[model samples]
Target: MHFLNRGRKLVRTAIALAATIALAGGGVTATADRASAAPVTPSPIAQAGTAAVKGSAKDGYQVYSRTSEAIRYTRTYDGIRVYGGDLIVRLKNGKVTGTSVGLAKPLSLSTKPSVTALSARAKATSAFRGKITSSGTPELFVDASDGTGKLAWETVISGWQPDGQTPSRLHVITDALTGAVRGSFDEIESVSGTGNSIYSGPVAIETTANDTGFSLTDPVRGGGYTCDMGNRTSGTCAVFTDDDNLWGTGANADRASAAVDAHFGAATTFDYFKNVHGRDGIFGTGVGVPSRVHYGSAYVNAFWDGAQMTYGDGSGNAKPLVALDVAGHEMSHGVTEHVVPGGLTYAGEPGGLNEATSDIFGSMVEFYANSTADAGDYDIGEKIDIRGTGAPLRYMYDPAKDGSSHGCWSTTTKNVDVHYSSGVANHFFFDLAEGTGVTAYGTSPLCGSAAPVAGVGREKASAIWFRALSNYFISSTTYAQARGYTLSAAADLYGFCGTEYKAVQASWTAVNVAGDDFCSAGNDFTLALSAPSVAVDPGTSGTVTVATTAINGDPEPITFTAGVVPAGVTVSFDPATVTAGEPTTVTVTADPGTPRSSAPVTITATAPSVTRAVSLAVSVNSSAGCTGTNGDDVAIPDNTTVTSTITIADCAVTPSSTASVEVHIVHTYIGDLVITLLAPDGTAYVLHNRAGGGTDNINQTYTVNLSAEAPNGPWVLQVRDAASADIGKIDSWSLSL
Candidate 1:
């Protein structure tokens, strides 16, 4: 089956054709003239991955960013890059400080493709029946959505859709070596509509007056033009021409009647983005989008195929699908594709985001036009009687009104059709712009346990979404990530931790999207350790500074505690307790007979209702000598996992020998830490799993049996901080074999 056919079925099934009626009265007649068109030019192929890193850069690895302070890297093996393999390194003015990786392990994969590119293309074409207008060379891609990577083939096939009027651009991904189709989606975004001379009503449209006469082409705005397909399946469409300057009679009886709405929609959508968001045009390059009307016999849909917009005549040719929102929705698809490269994957959560993006701008365009004929509202496709009951196709205020649409987010959201899944984001945008409960637009209800949200105004909300779409979003972005990026965008446009940022957070939460509200002004206190980690040798002592600052409500006393001390180690706080804005010193002492190993310690501070933790490292050097240490400072952000590796070289041990590890960590709330030791052979031993309760710091040594294992390879000590609010780092560690 075709990818978008499912969505068409949903719309057709839900549509109640009992209330079909004429939208506007009168018809504008116009004569059509044949015009020559330039040959179609293929779109330039995008480079598969980021520019190759030079100078000692390994194959399948690329640098994501670089600055005097630090550099970020990602893995791209054999031309197929990891989707979320981002590694960030911190530097102190040019000196190396610390490093953190997005992936759990290094990327390693075979570069050879077992299936040929021709075979991949053939599979795509066979899956969907359509004339091939354009095809791109299949490229190797890695499926890394689940943290692990798998190689696959990504192919693009475009041509006339099986529905005829709706063009198709399908992206089919197949397992490179197995020839198994992993997933597929249509790139062209579309919406079904009904017939009738639909107009936003009396809007000014730009026209070009040539030597012959005036045409339905706008020379003042990106050279966009509206043409009549003449109800033919094949051949060039003629541009609408008129001897008089005025066009369209607000009725679908004449071919030029629908052109008025189509032309006006294009202009209004362009102005909305340009004036409100500072964007130049749909592609942000002042490029025009051609509009083709009257496509196919009894057609009932409109779509945007990458470069242009096409509308079909409604059932019985009595209605043209050139409604304002429909036109704006179609063109906005082009904008999204150009704004976010790869166009949001066109399936799953990303696909829902893509569709929701168009719906958002389409509604904005209607508001921008503000024509009395079709008053601006949150209702989508309301003017078009596609549902036959005079009801809109989807309601942003309550998506469930359409039956199939999801009013809120859930785990199964991505499994639904993009159009239905889009309801979650659409509702989010509405709530963000208009708040919950009664409003000028409509009443919005909260999802799950979300609190009622206050509107940030459509103007500011649209700006935040546009900024995120243009600058922050990626093809595989999830709804949770959308919340983060939008928050980031709001921060960039307004200010961090401001009202705008708070509204963005509240809006997403109202749609049941779980995210951190870091900008919230409710935090009572801030906790930090003077250093990321500390190192202490056997028979020696190390001290770290624990600082607490007042925020929101303060001046409360904070009690200090210790967590997971080594067998031969003891930890104590100099001031044990202090009020907010005071600093305390944590002293960790190791016994002279301490075993040669690494131990992780945690320090926690607790007030009336606020508690935080940091991690520290304690190492006991082997009296026999052969140990390595890493003192790099790693930042463990809240609710994230981070790893620090210590390599022990030139060390050999017997096969049946036991190994000792000394780990030191400086973090708040050791109870939230999960530390593990990963050997070279992939054997992992859990050192600590929130074992310290509410105590803080990990200054301990662990002894593990290394029998039947090799002891001369890189060992990794992984530390994960699994809760919110508390954060710390892996200070240093030593290994003895």
Candidate 2:
């Protein structure tokens, strides 16, 4: 299948759809469009071990900032590479500052493969539908894309496509032990999925100045250029050159005609990504990808081969496949490949997601252009008649309109072909952008009695999708994960309380994709905290708003309670129990004796069988209270020791770790003085041991932990002059419990 016109193509390319990067920071196979990567050195701590059981950066999956001095490493268990075993280390001022990891759990398995390499290769080759010209050695590796790391074999099958005109490179993944077909990545990135010919008319295109005249290259935009395939199936194609740079006559016979649409599509797609999504280029590095037009005689498809975009002239050269949306669609595949490591795997639900990503972005690009000749709409390949009939390749508003696509999800959603399974997400994106029922685009239907949804507009919807795809999505991300990540993206972009966040939840549900957490739409109520955490001093109080929204039903009585309260801390609810809807106030008070420490506090709301909870980090600050002072002075001769007692009483709790002691000693040689605190249990904690030379009095405050001792008892202050020089006296001393 190729871009937009999946079935229109004679044979599948199998390259673009097959390269899935199971792990972030992991290799994307040497031939996956990008240059072969060098083996990433692993940090000493980047191991597939128990560290991931803790669910932290220590797990080996890490994120790095481009500006930070961070080195990324991919792990290998035994001998094979551990795909998800990724981590990053950062340095500051020539010192190791921090590290993070991505492994979800420890991976410990025998590297020895039960299945032979030939057997694995056979299994992988059997899955490849195209004719094979050659096969790669079956290499062993750890497939940790699913979080459960296991031994797997990767085999590359390269050859001519079934069409015989286009080439095919299919990467098949097989389980090493079971020899079962796990997944595959194809070279052809299809939209199953438009530009002109005959579609978009009289469009402006950028060109580069050459020695003779002008080349179909946009030096202003990454130097990407369009070329003619010369009706040949293989070999390099000559770059298109024009004299006046006037180029196309708005006709396919002009040769430069289809080239005009292809070039405009690449530039428009580039602009849409840069201006709307802030992406620098197809690969985010500001580097442009080349586009080849008029590929093969009467060819019927266009594809984003890991490296470039190739468009075939339609049947009889009468209908070229270079429509604006189709161009945008093919170029989008490159963005997907570059944005997400090796790109989304081209099989099952992930493959559908990959296709839907292109379609959605392509449609958005068309909308962004809003060309007068070809007005934007939520349709794919509406201009080019790739389907023989005048119908568009796929309808975004109603994917099922094409007959094979599933508008709603089901148990077998993951098992269907990527082209058809994409219907779910395409329908969802449409609902998200235009809402359900009649709209400017088309009327959208709801699934399984889903709640009515309101549109969030294309700008917000596209932003949310791009954010999720680039940041939160992994190669194996499924519909459920997509739902969660998109909601997270919406919340990140437009706060959880806004209409945008709610629309994300509503739209996903409208397409029958359910998630655990919802912003405002569900059968039960929803709960969220205004602030995730708070800090307060002892004897003070902090308040957090507990908001609850009843979704799709009436108020279910929700009783609010604090899970665990630390010592000297009291938690109170404004209204302990209420019907879930109105916001509740949670007041946390720390007494004067509360210690300076932080702990996780869970605020739970229970109603019937539904329970919602949020964690609030409570930090209590210690106070300088409970001080016992004595103003009377004690005489101390040279080399003699004098003790002062300040009895502590009426203290409710033991002293905190930050207990303080104030000592005032007058001496000619202050270096001879030593001060200490004696607890009621006779446990002496040294405060200071003489250090000054021949100085004056020593007046200072020392902080220490007295948590283990009694709060109400005699706390003695001991001062001694170790050196026999200049007699001194203990002026005064005090103890703060």
Candidate 3:
């Protein structure tokens, strides 16, 4: 079938892209798209290892016509690439029937009944239903595959409802064959399944609450639990525990379920952060941040307001996105706040880094959880379905692969959407921690590169980076600072010249951060000014600018600030800005508070302090022309021809012809430029003149060929100047062959 796939282009081009290095140190196999071959022959079935059973044409029609819960199954036995086909079935009466493949109206085949047939309707029903051992609870064992047409990733369903509905309960059992917990014995019920949370229920609540230090209470259906919201002055508002007599039909019960989901989410998030980055909690210490689920009435989003995390029920389209990754992401903000207490004020590079930290950790958390109900993957926010497109928020393999993300950066990288903008650093982290080729980590083919990691694992790298952020990097940090701090951290943990340090350097380099030169060379100047931090809220626009230091020999004191702010805000920079030096402070102010308080920005400097010209001029002079007389020749025979001349350039020049000559010239270029001379006899002489000369003389020269008697004609001399010519030059030429 000609099914169209939109993600083909980006997925294919992900591997061959070029990467730039950081000044300082640093550093799509498309198998699924192939066409399938046509089936050669179609015959009857033999032994049934896994029966490829086909239903009759009437059965197939009934599958579409019947309202029963029986689901229809279709399998492309060869591969998923083929288009149309038919079904052949054998009935209980030993009657054979064939159905033509047609979407509108299928053709049916008549079958000839056999004399020896099984006459029993009871036996027919028994074939579809597998043997069941446990019967009481909400548990059943079928061909596990029979449960869903084929295998499927499990999804938990939990929540609350009215009094008549069944109370939520637990169910767990192992598959008879695989021993996997494919079917659950527990069954729970609520009033409305729409409001039910997947991560709630007994097991999740108990396990999650125990994992976190928080305590759990009875399923307070419709009751708002009381918890301290920290300081009220800073907008840290707390909710009072109240069991309202009148609540949404079963929203309160569902909200309780949401609370359990939140708890489980917190547990997974905490474990991921600690296990991955060695961070104790959001605060690096053992301080756990409180997450209140079902914050307001259908408040679609989940956010961390500088203090604690809050989750809200989504509208009709989406569910409450308290998934592990999302919870980890929101909680990461609190971690960032604790780490860099100054907030996202220090905009630009640092701000971008801060935002990216959350995304990176979020992906890491998903990777750690590794739950089938919510399998770990690089795709961000897929379970939440925030976009309703069945895709994800951002793709790590190719951020732009989903068409909603930025993918990579351009000169105007700062102008993209913040969600997309976060891609720049995300790409850096991926390429840095992982190298340029395909990785063999057994991960989904999403990340095209074969090299999952360059030198060390992401765990070590993240650990070092976290240490760097907590110990070395400040609130107003820049990409440069991050590179350095990370390198330093890696160095401290793995040794200065270890693979981890090199990988860290390489990753930043790939992301286009010129690490070696992020800082001014030779100039030891510190700027209190750093990259501004940012926060992107649902319906608000905020802007922040980061000021740059003036280079001593900067043709002019150029005021640097990012311009052409995105739609959300009218972001502006200052001097409208330049802080001349110490004591001269340049302030980057955001106008009219944003819908969300924090928004991220990344500022980089294209110009640096020190300037040194690396241009050199070279010159050389030797034999101008050669003259052969009878004085040196014992016999100047009749047809005998003699010639000699030395031609030289500013750099070393070799005589190319049988006749030798050196012509004076300048080698104002770097590297080796070739000199060639062709003799009249069609013979050519060549030499490679290496370019570096301290005294501005011939570094190396050679007289190619010498002949007492040579053909007498104007010998052609060709000088092929070397490509890399920054330190030397080429001048006059003379030749005789």
TM, every model: 0.61, 0.62, 0.39
Ranking by lDDT: 2, 1, 3
Which ranges in model 1 have alpha carbons more than 4 Å from their true place? 1-106, 129-137, 143-148, 158-160, 193-197, 519-737
Encode model 1's per-residue lDDT on 634-736: one tens digit a residue.
7778878888776656644342234667776656578899989888888988888875544444656567766556656788888888888776666557666
Clashing residue pairs in all predictions, respectively, total 43, 28, 70
* Winner on lDDT (1 vs 2): 2
Q: Which regions of candidate 2 deviate over 4 angstroms?
A: 1-76, 83-104, 191-197, 519-610, 613-737
Across 1-737, the per-residue lDDT of candidate 3 in tens digits comes to: 11115422111001111000000000001111111355532222211001123222232211211012111122232232111122222222222221111111111222222211121111111111223222222222121121112111122223221222222232332222222222221221101113323432232322111222223321211111222223111244343232322111212343444444554556556656676666665554554455555444444555554444556555541366566667766666566655443222222344456667777777777667666566666666666666656666776656666664444444434423345556666666666554544554212122232223363655675677666655444433545556766765676578764677767766666555544423232442223222223322223322322222332333323334443333334434333333333112222233332221222333332224532211111111122233221111121122222233332222122332333344322333323445555555557666544333211212222455545324444454445544442222222243432
* Alpha-carbon runs more than 4 Å astray in model 3: 1-254, 274-278, 344-347, 437-455, 517-737
**Per-residue lDDT of candidate 2, residues 1-737 (tens digit):** 22224333222111100000000011232211111247654332332122222122222333322323444444557645666454443444433333333333346577788889999888667655558889999889888765556788999998866677666788877778766555666776643212234765555566665456667776656777778788887778788887776777776777877777777777778778899988786767676657787777777777766777777777777777777777777777777766555567666677789889988988888888788777789888887877777899889888989876879988667645677788999999999988999999898999999998889899999999998876566566678768866876787689864888889888989999976575444448767553456666788887666667565456789999998878888888878887765656778899975776667898989988588887887767545446677756588787777888988767665676777687666565677888888898999999877765553456566778888888878888888878775776665576766
* Candidate 1 to truth, TM: 0.61
Candidate 2, RMSD to the unseen true structure? 27.8
Candidates 1 and 3 compared: the better one by TM-score is 1
For model 3 the TM-score comes to 0.39
Candidate of highest TM-score: 2
